[model samples]
Target chain A: MHRTLHPLTSLCFILFFFVIALFGAPTTQMVGVMILLSAASSIRKRKQAWKKIALYILPIGILLFLVNSAFGAPFSRGLAYALRFVLLITPLVIVLLGGSPTDFRLGLRTVPIPSRLHYLFIFSFEIIQSLRDVFQAVYIGQQLRGYNANRSLGNKWKNIFPLLLPVMLIAISQGLDRSLAFEFKGIESPAEKIYLRTLTLSPFDKLSIAILLLSSLGLIVASFILP
Target chain B: MITIKDLSFRYKQEARNSFEHISLHLQDGQALGVIGPSQAGKTTFAYALAGLLQKHFRGGSLTGTVIFDAQDQAPGTSEIGFVFQDASLQLSGVTETVEEEIAFSLEQFGVPRDIMRERIEEQLSTFHLIGLRYRHPKTLSGGETQMLAIASEAAKHPRLFILDEPTQALDADHVRHLIDFLRVAKRSSTIIFIEQNMSATFELCNHVLFLENGRQQFLGTPHDLLNSNIDVSSLTLPELIDVQRSLGRNHISLLFKETIEWMKKCRTSA
Candidate 1:
């Protein structure tokens, strides 16, 4: 819950929770745990909590319930699988909404991914953000240029299509041009080296990592014994 | 310093040279102001000097030599840095933070670990961006973004800085900051400024070079260029320059102190 957790540790915790939920025993228990995590995050930021559950988590839960009811096999078994999916996704949603974009990049840096791929990831993220802005701007521009009655649902959707395609293309081209400029500025040059100072692993990181290791080990032992 | 002798260039698709027989020289520590109507090759000349005409761009045939700091140099020489009119095109950072944006280039040079953090921190404070170091570059006001670009390039410490109408995206306040920043650059580096804002040009540059229709119309000290027999009404000069011109004041000194003294002389003579 503390914001002081290193970005890497937060990422590790989220990934670890999902891996266990997807692969460990008692899927329903994992699902409950996931929902609990999301509910906890929601307490801090109510709107984000509502959005995560409503948009992705709730729909997933409903689908699981329908499937379990129809199949009706170890009724609890179906419920458990559905619960697992919900639990698997909760930590991810919490992490995504918890920090600003820079923290996201910093977390990614802690991973073993290549730097070029990192640049592309950053570039795409900006492109998406810019595309959203461009569409809104174009809509405002359209209204200002004399298209008044845009209140009706059908008219609004139609207005969006015309606005969407052009903005999307412009955003794509702008992204490419910016990427080329970065290349010209030598962002891709391997010869250009940066010295990264070693970051000390904090107690929070050690604890989260320990929890992941212990749970994963427990799952391995239980699966062998139960099998 | 730049000297172009009988220089001519034509884009591959175009029929004629954009400019022919062009020759000009910019002195050290002097700010050169280039003015011309559109399609007059104002940007083309600036590009040619930076060697970007052939390096960064194509579809042009250039036959001329460009000398930088008394030495012939190729495109993107360490001695010269360029600023386009569009600040967005030049800045490369997804994060909104100004410090991260300026660090983009220094990181490229592989600046020593000992200096990187200090340099980044210094630029953020010097450009009045300390408080906004964490703010997004895309969210920054037009002037702040321009200042960010200037700050980024300044960290490189290029000897010759060429700004191609950098004030176009800026407002009155930003324009002044840009001029003031250039005044600081002029103290240590020669600057070639191409702008339609003559008032800005008059305020900062002592040396003026006028380009009209891709031809060098006038090149001299600001005093002679404006005070001579020239139709400057189209130039839309600042009110001060207009009054000086109407009165036939021959010495329109560019130094702020000198201009103040000249104003006294004009009032006394009248």
Candidate 2:
């Protein structure tokens, strides 16, 4: 079902969840709504994806809880805040993990956003992903050469410059190469771009959007009524 | 036809030009091999030919007249496809699947969806990427990625193709495949092939341009290049050519197969 949803439909749900997370009352009911939405978005995702989402949320949630408790907040209040943070961030991670950059571009096309802006947005994700891969490769290479960052705290700090210098140089070179590649492909041509796969609102997509709207309305109403 | 005259370029803040006084003329449907050692400005020359040096290198100073007299009117950069040396960097990172990577350029060109599909399928088949059509472009091996890069550019069917050291990272099998592809590609597209391998250059190119220290040392047919006195010791010259040079046999064929046949004839005659 997640695979069949149009990019626009998925984006609509994501925006809906984000708006609720931002504006709704920080109540247990709101967190429950977020959990339901996040679970629905992640239904078709893999276990690895779920672990990634948890990895994103857990450390921050723990930090938030620790900080709140240190500030003399009640245990229940701190736990609730931590849980709220987890619920608020989970859906976004799920959507990002579930969709590819191509899907994001497809979704952006229907909007009146400037083509360059959307292209930049999409390329930022790709650049970060590629840079992460490069950093991992460099890190592993250094580790194999016996430059262990795990040796001590000072060693970790000492290894930072040597590790980052090559990655930064490669990043700059790769950025130039990528821009040239993009130019050769005519990405900025004045011609009206055409898509190989057209995005149409299927019945499933319509249903998804409809469900999203109804769920948001119900959640807002429940938030106002609940204690 | 492509004609370049008095071409020279220097990057901003550089004391000397990267390459200077290089000129060549290639008829339509011909291949020109550009060979030289490192820092000979081979890639810079390629960028100039592709019109990128002027269009993209805004900080650089360029002086030259590059005329691409194609069948159509004045050719824009769109009529030229360039494959960089690094196949990984050449890929459009936004695409997920192999077929999408090929369709990416066509989409930007605003090709009709039906025509785009046809071109994508044709390129996939041509580059032997049909089996990996649904696979992620990032997951492909080095050779497969290189093939995808070439396939993506070839799908454009540009008037000219500039391949910069394409076989550098390729193994023997992939090299043979690339040679086969170029043999077919050269019939339609004028090719500026920058290569280190002497045999592939001699086999695939009609004309050769030898660059050294930012200077055009030689420019002519491969036969003329071999006959010329310009030192080519830096290049990995084919064994037969080396042997011929050592034996003072200037009449030796530039092609390995032809030289082998010549050796057979010599033995039979004796």
Task: Give Cα distance to truth, residue A54, candidate 1, Å.
Answer: 6.4
Compute the DockQ of candidate 2: 0.72
lDDT of 2 by residue, A1-227 (tens): 45745677777677666556644665643565556455645556657556865576778888887888776778866666676676667666667667765656676776676667877887788888888899999999988998777778887888777889899999999999988988888887889988787556778878888887787787778777876
How much of the real interface does each model capture, measured as fnat?
A: 0.33, 0.84
When just chain B is superposed on the true chain B, each candidate scores a TM-score of: 0.85, 0.92
Best model per lDDT: 2
Model 1 chain B worst lDDT run, 10 consecutive residues: B73-82
What docking grade does candidate 1 earn?
acceptable
Error of 1 at A65 (Å): 2.1
Which DockQ values do the candidates obtain, in the order shown? 0.33, 0.72
Give one digit per residue, the lDDT tens place, for model 2 in B1-270: 987889899999999999999887899889999999999999999988877777788999999777778432335556778999999999987778999999999988888999999999989877788999999998999999999999999989888999999988788887888888888998999999999998889989999999998899999988988888878888889898987787666685676788778777767977
Model 1 steric clash pairs = A28-A80, A31-A83, B40-B214, B96-B135, B96-B136, B96-B137
lDDT of 1 by residue, B1-270 (tens): 667677778878888777767777767778888876677787888777766677655767888666665667653543465776677767876545677777776666667766867877767766777888878788888788888877777765667788888888788877877787788888878888998888888778877877766666787877788667765555767767666656666765445666667889768988
Give the native contact fraction of candidate 2: 0.84
Chain A TM-score, cand. 2: 0.65
